[model samples]
Target: MSEILFITREPFAIQGNSRPALHIMPDAVYALVVTDPSLDFEENRAEPGYGTLLYKAPASSDSSDEETTGQTTLHRFAFTRKDLRSTCTEAPVVLKLLEIAKKLKAHVLSDYGALYFRDENGLVNVTEDAQAKSYIMGDKGTRYALTPDGALADPASLPAYLAENDFSFLPETQAEPRAEQPQHSEKPEKPQANSHAPAAPDYCKGMGTLKCSLFSRAYQKNVQLSINAYYAWCLSFLSGINCGYQDFPEQMLRYPIYPSTSNEDIAFLNAYCTRNPDDPFISACLALRTMRLERQ
Candidate 1:
């Protein structure tokens, strides 16, 4: 909900602190957490960091600067933690998150064991926007404002923060995430569950990186393969990849697969909405509830 939240104290952080520790604080009011009705732009914060509060994502002007901290080096941007925190309206919340990280003594990437993920380039790159966001949000919390390598500089501060505050993870956190890898695997050298085995899907090869973790877990067993009319349409689109132009009318709903939507499904939806007036089942249901007592 679009509601302004007044913090008991202003939130701000010292210059150096860990990203994960800062993310887990209750005093750190997330734009998503504090709003009762949720404003239009509050939920759409773009590109991580302080950008989490507002949605305007200035396209990453960052170049992939390669840096070697010696062991297994990667490309990552260099930015200060203080600069990122100032983007938020509230200072106390930001300070609280920083304090939490300082007390936890947790290294956002190392504690989470996500530092080693390699991207398509075979580099354990940390400068990528996605990588930065992952580390910033690595700590358990709804809202966050942190930067890459922000945690490495200040592990000692985290313990003190943990001593003062008691924090908990969100319920949605229990959902089986696709990307969590075991801390130390017998086959850390191998990607899939069975290293000795021949292999599984080609996509499985990307499993070692943190980016593919969630997807890897899902690919292991969650997704079921089946065919339906939508599947047929999807196949048709796939089959048309190399084909010459044909006058096939595109469907509206995902009638197929990834690019779902069928002309038929769209037609059905439109017809259903026209008859019911509310346009969708959700709207129809809401209308029903709104009028339920009125009719009586």
Candidate 2:
């Protein structure tokens, strides 16, 4: 499904570079923005009123936490430091958000925040290379990342990348019927003691591209294979397929695991591989076997 990736610093954490690393998909169907309580408010403030409503709370609630503090007309809620987490209405909420931000003249962005949305062509980022920390707002249900530069460069050439990576798109529609093999037109079969067997299907190529990208960037260096690596792999793999299923990789646990870490895991992975040897993640990883990066 479509998702939004919210890139933000770990509010109060004191370790590692405060760069974007977490991936947050929108958990609900609405979009909203919560204003800093310090900002002055007026009920009739927004011109032509973009259906903007003022959220009220007891002064005591503000000191408690975000959950206890506000009441919106809608229920499902999520938040970020910039308070872009609010109720989404019938209209495209981001446009309304831009309107509200302009009206409030609030210091609208974090030092470095960006909004990344998926389009037919692939994913695109609204903000590029934000200098410091910043904030982004949208109701696009897209994925996000907190990068210093706010860019996730596309693979060098997507088709070539996909092909070279050995990923294949599933047939979008029903298949045409095949003519039957000619009956009783048998030529003498060649008899050999050891004719070469068909090559094993390559399943690791694209998955390996993910591993290489992570390793080159030190995201997976010296780490045991974990779900986070798998999650990143799923994200990278989904970026290439044109299967027409918008919610590809809906959950990481559903992604295939080939080249399993143990015999038991291998048993399961092999079963999946047997059924889907040309699976996108596996095929791509096998095709792009030479994924080692050369650095200066």
Candidate 3:
């Protein structure tokens, strides 16, 4: 599993190149970051930002703790120290960090406090304090708090009322299942061999490009798409295929195309985008159809 160890220190605590002392665990496999006053910086800064992401050297009997701490600097952001706080969470760096976290399946942690994990929706902040209100970022960038009863407490009332509720009543959160495959008749009619390919549905016409990036991100993380997007895409792809099958039952049957409810199509698109980020999202969907045909 991927992990990241985040260490935060008091602002300006490191004087004259002195670094924080890190206790390296022998089995630790995580990306390391050390920052002043921690990564959970307060909003706003008067100057530019700066920081470093370190890759720990493999643990060895011959290596001292200091030698194993930061063997290679994977990334560094440099600016005026005063601005480092603001820059650390800038869009570009945040995206990069999220991408890294997703790849590593990293659970974001602060040395001082809080734990975070990335899911299909986005980052979820789960605190150790049961009474503390946990927050999650929505796909549309809205912030919602999880109440003790597991309801999404009103965002407007979050600050004022969330803390007042005792969290001992909080129930264990269960993982939602991925997309459910649509039920189909056990025996499907075969489409005619000479039938033309199905036309794209109206709803799907311009959706691929619009939804591609979001789908790509979730695909890379091997998670399901957001609820609305998943259902919409399913409706489009499956409806079109069903229409074609009804129109030409015989031909379509020879090359059966089973709709993937487990995100096989997303994986295909992810690979497609990795090869060419600029490729139209619809092109990958079309290619997936062809692949299914060949496999059949």
lDDT of each: 0.27, 0.29, 0.35
| Displacement of the residue 228 alpha carbon in candidate 2, Å | 59
Q: Please, what is the TM-score per model? A: 0.17, 0.17, 0.26
Best by TM-score: 3
> Tens-digit lDDT track for model 2 on 1-296?
22332222221122342222221211110111212232222222222111223333322212111234344222122333223333332223333333443332221222233433323554332444343233322222122222334332232332332332121111221132557545577995653211111232455353443322333233224344543454456445544442444574332123243443222232222222222233333432322211110000
Off by over 4 Å in 2: 5-82, 86-91, 103-113, 116-125, 131-296
Residues 195-274, candidate 1: write the lDDT tens digits. Answer: 11122233422212122222222333434231133224333433443253244322111222233333222222222223
On lDDT, the candidate that comes out on top is 3
The local lDDT score (0 to 100) that residue 59 gets in candidate 3 is: 35
Pairwise TM-score winner, candidates 1 and 3:
3
lDDT of 3: 0.35
